[model samples]
Target: MSLNDASCTFESMTSPTTLKTSTEPPLVSAVHWTRAQWLLLMVVCTVLALDGLDVSMVGVALPSIGQELNLGTDSLQWIVSAYVLGYGSLLLLGGRLADLLGRRRIFLIALSVFAAASLLGGLVDDPAILIATRFIKGLAAAFTAPTGFSIITTNFAEGRERNKALSIFTTFGASGFSLGLVVGGLMTSLSWRWTFLVSVPIAVVVVFLGMKFIPKDKPSAENSGHDIWGAVTLALGMLGLVYTLVSAPEQGWGSVATIAGFAVSIAVLAAFAVIENKVKHPLIRFSILKEGWVARANLSAVGLFGSYLSFQFIVTMYLQSVLGWTPLGMALALLPAGLLVATSAPFADRLIEKFGATQLILTGLTALGLGYVLFLRVGTTPNYVLDILPSVVLLGIGFALAFPSINVQATAGIKDSEQGLAAGLIQTSTQVGAALVLAVTTALVSGHGQAAGTVSAQAMLEQYRPGLILSAAVAIAALLVAAAPSRRRVRT
Candidate 1:
C-alpha cells in the first residue's frame, strides 16, 4: 500500500476517546497531517535525501573518476575524505546556527550552496577543484541536515506525531543512499560526472519549495551576542580531530603526524570547553550531554553508523575485487537492506511507540551483531542464499529498527530552543565515529594483506575477515551500552 493509504488506515484505527479533549488543537499523527504539513516535511526530507544521494553516488563513481582524472589512489582517496572532513567538523556549528538564526533561513541558504557546489563539482576538470567542490557540498550538507531535522522536531508535537515524522524523514534519507548505488552504476556507465550533476536540479526544486512552504521566524533577541571564539575553537578542534582519524590508516597509527594531530585536536577542544563555560552566549551548551539518554543515543548512533560503514567497505571489496561482480550487481545484492529500511516507514514509528525506543534499540543491535557474525563464515565460493542473504536481511532489519529510534531518543526530552543543538550532536557522533571505525578497519585489512603477500583468493578473503570481526565487536559493545540499567539516569 502507498504511504497515504497506510496513514489513512492508522487514522481509522485510532479511537476518538484516546484523542486529546482540550481546546488546544489535537495533536495529529503524521498519517492525518494536512497537505501543507506533509509538504513541509517533504521539503526537509528531500534535502536530507540529497545529502545521502550525493555521498553514495560519488562513492560508486570513484573508480571512473580516478580513471578519467589519471589520479593515484592517494589523490582519489582525498576526493571522498575531503567531503567527510568538512561534514564531520562543522555539524555542531551548523545546528547551533539553525537555532540562532531561523531554521528556514539557514536551511534555504545552505541548500543553495549545496546546489551551487554540485554544479561546480560536475563541471570541474581539475582534481583539486573537484575535491574543493566536494568539501563545499559537504559543508553545506552539515548545515542542511541538522536544520532539516530540527525543523521537524520543532514543527511536530513530541509523541507519536514527531516519531512518525522522523521515521519517514530518515527512511527517505536511507532510501536515497540505497537507490543512489543503482543510479550511480547507470550514470557512471555514461559518465562519472552525471552522479555529481544529478543532485543539482533536485536540490534546486527543494530550495524553491522550502521558500514557499516553510514558515519563517526571527532569531532570539535575548541571545544576540555572538560566540566568535567558541565557534572558532570548536570548528578547528573538530576539523583537526576528523582529519587525524581519516588519515591515520595511511599515515601509520603510531606515526608522529597522527600523534601530533590528536594532541593538537584534543588541546583545542579542551579550550573550547573552557570557552563554553565562561562565555555569556556559548556555541554549544555542554549540559546537554549530561542527560543520560541523550548521551547513550549519541553513542548508539556512533556504533550504528560506524559498524555499517565498515561492513559496507568490506562487502564492497569482497564483491568487486574478489568475486569480480559488476558495480550494478553489488548494488543489487545490497539493495535488500535499503529496501527494508524504506518499506519500514509505515510501521517504524508504531514499533517505537509500542516497544519503546530503548527496547527496539537493544533488539536491533542484537540482530546487527548476529548479522556480522554470520558473515564471518564467508568462503571463496559461497552460496548467496545460504551465506549472504540471511545476514543481509538481518542487517536490514537491524538498521530499519535502530536508526529512527536512536534519533527519537536523542531529541525526546530536549526543549525546542536547543533542538538543533541536540540534532547536531547526534549527527556529528555518527560521522566522526564512523570515520574512526572505518579507519581502524581499513588498517586491519591492509595490515593483514601485507603480512600475507601474494596470497590466493581464499587467503585474500581471510584478510578482510578481521575487519568484519571488528564490525561485529563494535555492535556487541553498543548492545551492552544500550542494555545497561538507567532508571536513575532516565529520570534525571
Candidate 2:
C-alpha cells in the first residue's frame, strides 16, 4: 500500500566462468571504488529511482486518468492494482532468476522490458490495454529492483562501505518517488500520456549506459531450471485473491464468486508450499525463513509499505477531486515530503547506529500512523498548512528511518549467493502487501454498504475516511510487529 509508486528485484548475464555458491562477494567496499564502480552504482541507482518516479507520478495521474477515461472508482483502482499484481507475484521468482541466470543479464533485460512497456502504455486508448501495460511494467520492475540491490551488495564489502552504498541507494530511490510526484504533475498538465511516455527516455539512457559500464556477470553453473509449477500457482493464486478483494464491494463477501475465488487462491498457494518443500532446487529455500529476522522483517515491510501507498492513493484523489487542485499544484504540495525523504534518507545510517533498527522501525510506524490520523481532519474545505503538511512530513520522516532498516533486517544474515532470494522475498512482501491491502481498502471505500452513495467531494471524504482509518490500523499492526519481544534476534 505504501507505494502509489514504490519498489524492485531480479537479472541477466552470460559467461564461461560459472557463478558459484561461495559466500564471498565479488567487490569489497573496504577497497576504494574505481571510476567504473562509481558509475555502475550511479546508473543502477538511477534505474531504481525511475521505478519510484513511475509510482509517484502515476498516483497523481490517476485522477486525470479517471476524468479522461470516464472510469468509475473500481476501474481507477485497477490501474494501480494491475501493476502491483504483476510486480508482487513475480518478485521471488525474479530474484531466483537473477541468482541462476546472472544479475547483469536480468538487469539489462528487465530495463528493456520496462521501457518498451512504457512506450506502448503512453500510446494506448483503451483502459484495459493501459492496465495490461502497467502490469507488464511491474513485471519488468520486479526483475530490475532486486537485481540492482544484489549488484550493490555483491559488489560492496559489509560494514561501512556496504552500509554507505545502501544509504546512498535509499536516498536515490526516495528521490525518484519524491521527484516523480512533481514531474508527473507537471507532465500530466500537458497530458496524462506524458507520464507513461516520460520514463521511456530515462530507461533507454540507463540501459545504454548499463551495456557499457555495468560489468558482465558469470553465469551460474548452479543454474537450475526454474520452478515452473511453483511460479504458476503462486501467480494465479495471488491474482485470484486480489481480484476477489477488488470485486468484493460489488459481489458481496459471501457471494459465490468471492468465496470461490478465495478458496482457489488458498488451495493454489498451499500447493506452492508443497512444491517448495519437495523440490531439490526450490525457487526459495523455506529454511531461510527459519531465521526470525527474515520472516518478521518481511511481514513488517508488508504492513509499512501497504499503509503508506494506500494513504497516498487516497490523498491524491482528495487533492484533485475534492480540493479542485491541478496535478501540478498537488505535486508542489507534496514536494516537501519528497524533499524531507531525500534529506533524511542519507542520515538514516547515523540514526540506525544511534537508536538501532528495532527502535527506529517502531518510531517510523508510529509516525506513519499519526500522519494518517492527522489526514482525517480534512473536510469539504481545504487547509493545506495544517491538515496535509503535517501528515506528509510525518510520513516522510517515518519512511526515511524504516525503509532502509527493513532492507538491512531482511538481508542481514543471508549468504552472498542467496542475497537475491532474500531481496526478492522482502520485495515480494512489499508489492503483495500493497496490492492486496490497496484492493481491500479501495473496496472499503467503494463497497456497497459502507460509504456514501454519490461520488461527490463530500461523499468521497466519507469514503476516504474509512480507508485512512484502515491505513492507520495497518501501521499500528506493523508497529506492534517491530515492538514484539522475541527470543531470536538478527543484526538490525
Candidate 3:
C-alpha cells in the first residue's frame, strides 16, 4: 500500500472528531482573522520564538562561553544537555498541569520563571551556576511551550484556521532559533552574557501582554487527581535515562556505572508505567501513544530534532573553533536555513492542504536526508557555496515543511481537554530525542580526543565527521518511519 495511494488522505490519519461540523458559524479565512485572534496567536508565537531564540543564541555563544570559563567540550555540552534534561523530563507533568490547573495561568507563571532564569544566567560567572540557570529556563519552557501550543489549538478551529495559526507559530519558533544564530553572533561579539540577557526584556514584555490578551478558561473537569506518584516516577525515570545517556561516553559505555544507570532508569520508568495503569487520573494516558498518527508524529519529531541539533552543534564547532570564522560570519553562513523557513511561513498551510501532510513529511524527510548527506562531504577548508549553502538551504526547506505538519497531525484528533497532552508528547520527543542523539554525538566526537581543546583543524574535522554521518543516518531512519503505512485510514 503506497502512502500516496489516493485512498490515504490526511484526514485518514487524524482522530475521528476532526470530521465533525463546527457548531459555531465559520469565521473568515486565517489571513483575515480578527485582532483578538491575531493577538492571541502572537502571544503564543512570541513565547515559542523566545524559546527558539534562547536555545540558538546560546548555541552560537558556546565557543566564547567555553573559552571564558575554560570549559572543555564535555563541560560545554552540559550547558545544552542540562536544558534538554529539565525540559524533556518534566514536560508530561507540565502538560497535565496546564490541562488541569489552567493553560493561561501555567503559561504566565512559566514565562515569568523563564525571564528570571535568563537574567540569572547572564549574571552568573560560575559555569555550574550558568548551566543550572539553563536547566531552570528549560523547565520553564517545558510548561510554556505546550500550554502555548494547546492555547492555539483550542482558540483556532481545527481544519484551516488552526493550521494557519500553527504554521505562523511554528515558523516564529524556527525563525527565532534561525535568526538567533545571527543575533547570538552579534551579542557574542559584545559579550557572551548579552545572549542570555537579550531575551529577558522580550520575555517580560510577552508576560505582560499575555496577562492582558490571553483569555481565561476553566480546567478540564475530567481530570480528578494530580497523580502524585506518577509525576515523581516519570520525572525520576526521565532524569536518570537522560543522565545515563549523557554520562555513558564519559563513564565508558560498558562500565558498571553506565550499566547501573540504565538499569535504574528502566526500573523507575517501569514503575511509572505500572502507576499510570492504576491511577485514575494519570499524568499521561499511555493510550495516547496507541494512536498511530500520534505515535508516528512523536517518533518523527525525535528524528527531526535529534539530527538537526546534533548537526548544528557539530557545525558550530567546526566553523568557529576549527575554521576560525568570526561569530557573525558563522551566523551568516547558517542564516539561509532560518531565512527559508521565515519566507515560507505564508505558504506552509496551503502546501499542507494541497499536498497533504503525509506527502510533505515524506518530502521534508527526503530533503533533510539529502541535506545531511551533502554536508558529509564538508572538509577542513570546504567552499561555503559549494559545500555548505546547498545543505543549509535544503535543511531550511525541510523544516519549513515538516515542523508544522507534525504539530497538526499530532493534535488533530485529540479533544480540546487533551490538547496539552498531545503537545507535551511531541515536545518531549523533540527535546529528549535531541538530548539523546546529541549526547551520543558529543561522546563520539569527544572520545576522539576533540576534548583536548588543542587538536588541529584536520584532526577536529575527522572527529566531527562521525557526528555528521549520524545526523544523516537519523534523517534516513525518520524518513523510513514516515513512509511506513498506517493500519487505519480516513481523508483530509
Candidate 4:
C-alpha cells in the first residue's frame, strides 16, 4: 500500500472510548494543516524526547545516586539495568496493546504512569524502591515512545512531510539525551532525587497538551487479543539476558548466577519463538524479520545506539575521573555535540531524499567509527576543543544521519495495523542491544577481576582505551551490515 492510500483510512475515525468509525478528511492530506495539529505533533515529539532524556539523564546522575544512597557498584549498575530491563522487555507487549486497544488511550495512561513513577522515585529512601520506580517509569516509557512514533507515522503525510516530521521528532529525542546530561548534572548538584522528580511536571504538561490536541484512535477489527505467552516469555527472557550481561563483569562469566541467567534467557526466548510461530496475532510476526531493509536497519540499530551510548559511558568516566571535570563541566562540554545533532538533523532528512537509507546508514556508521577512533587518541591532558570537540561533532553528525534514514527505511513498508509493534521492535533492539553492549564495554574497561571504580586513572585509561576501539569496531560492523543488502527488495 502507498502512503496516500494509508492516509485514506485515517479519514474515518472513532471516539476515544468507542469502537465506532467516522468520515473526516484524511489528516495526512493537510501537510500545511491547522495549529492544533501542529500542537499535537509537538506534544508527541516531547513525549518521545522525555523517553530518550530519561535514559541519558539518569546515566549522568548515577554517581550522585550512588553517593546519596551509599550504594555499591553493583547497585549502581542496577540503576541502569532496572530501566533498560523494563523498557526493552515490555516494548513489544506495550506496542501490541496500543494497537489492540487505542494509541491515544495508551499514550495518555502511560504519561500519567510516568508522572506517578517519577514521583515515587523522588520520594523513595531505599535504593531498591528507587530502582523499582525507575523500572516502572521505564515501563511507562516503553508504552509511550513507540506508540508516539506509530502515531506520527499514521498522522503525518508520507514522503517528504512525514520524513521531515520524523527527523524533527528524532532531533528532539537526540537533543533530549544530550540536554538530559546537562539537566541531570545541574539537578544532581541540587539533589539526585530531582532527576526523577523533574520529569513529573514535564509529564503533566505533555499529558494535558496531549489530551487536548491528540486525535482519537480508531481500532482495527483484526487487532483483537495479543499473544499472552509471548509477552511472558519475552519479558522473562529479556530480563534474564540483561541481568546476565550486567552481572558478568562483576561475577565471572562462568559463575553459576551468570550461567543460570544465560541459560534461562536462551531457553525462554527459544520457547517464545515456538509460541509465536503457533499463535495467531503473535506480538511479532516471524515474516517481518525477512524484510531486507527492516533487518538491515535493526542490525545497525544494535550497533549504532549500543556503541554510541557505551562510548558516552567511557567519555563520562574519563571526563569526571581522569580529567577531573565537574559534572556540570562534563555536560557543558557535550552540549555542543547536542547542538550539532539538532543542526544536522534538518539536513539529514534531505540527505535521505538524496542518498537513500542504505548509503546514509553506511556513511553515518563510517563517520561514527571514525569518531570512536578519534577518542582513542585522547591523552590524560584535557583539551576540550582540540581533543573531544571534533569527535563529538562527528558523532553528532553521524547519529543525525543514521537515525532518521534507518527509521524511514525500517517503517516505510510496514502496514499501519502493525506499525506500533514494528516501532516497538526497533526500540527494543536499541535498548536490548545497548544493555548487552554496555556490559561488554564495562567488562572491557574494568578488565578481568577488577572491581568497577577501584582503578587508578592511568590503569582505567589503559583498560578504557581498548573499549573505545571495540566501540569503533561495532560501528564498522554496522557499516558492513548496511553494505550487504539481501537480493530481495525491502518490504513496502
**Which residue pairs of candidate 3 clash?**
11-491, 11-492, 12-490, 12-491
Tens-digit lDDT track of model 1 for 31-89: 57989999999999988888888878888899999999999888887888888999999
lDDT of 2 by residue, 1-492 (tens): 232101101000011022222353433223367898888899889988988888888877887899998998668767776777677767887887898889999999999999999999999889999999998988898899889888888887654556667767866877798779899888888899999999899899999999988888875556566678877886777667766765666677788998998899899989989998987777777878866368878988999889988887788778887888877888888888788778875576555544445666777888989998888888988678988899989988888878877776677656777888888988888887876677677677666223345667787678678888999999999988777665443322
lDDT of 4 by residue, 317-428 (tens): 8888888899999999888878887777656656655545666677788889999998888888857788899898889878888877777766766778778877888888
Instruction: Show where candidate 1 strays beyond 4 Å.
Output: 1-31, 451-455, 487-492
Error of 2 at 296 (Å): 1.7
Local distance difference test, each candidate: 0.85, 0.78, 0.86, 0.78
Looking at candidate 1, what is the lDDT of residue 43?
A: 98
TM-score: model 2 vs. ground truth: 0.87
Q: Model 4 off-target regions past 4 Å?
A: 1-31, 448-456, 489-492
Error of 4 at 198 (Å): 1.3
RMSD to the hidden true structure, all candidates: 5.6, 7.3, 3.6, 7.1
Model 3, position 394, has a per-residue lDDT of 96
* Angstrom error at residue 351, model 3: 0.9
Count steric clashes of candidate 1: 0
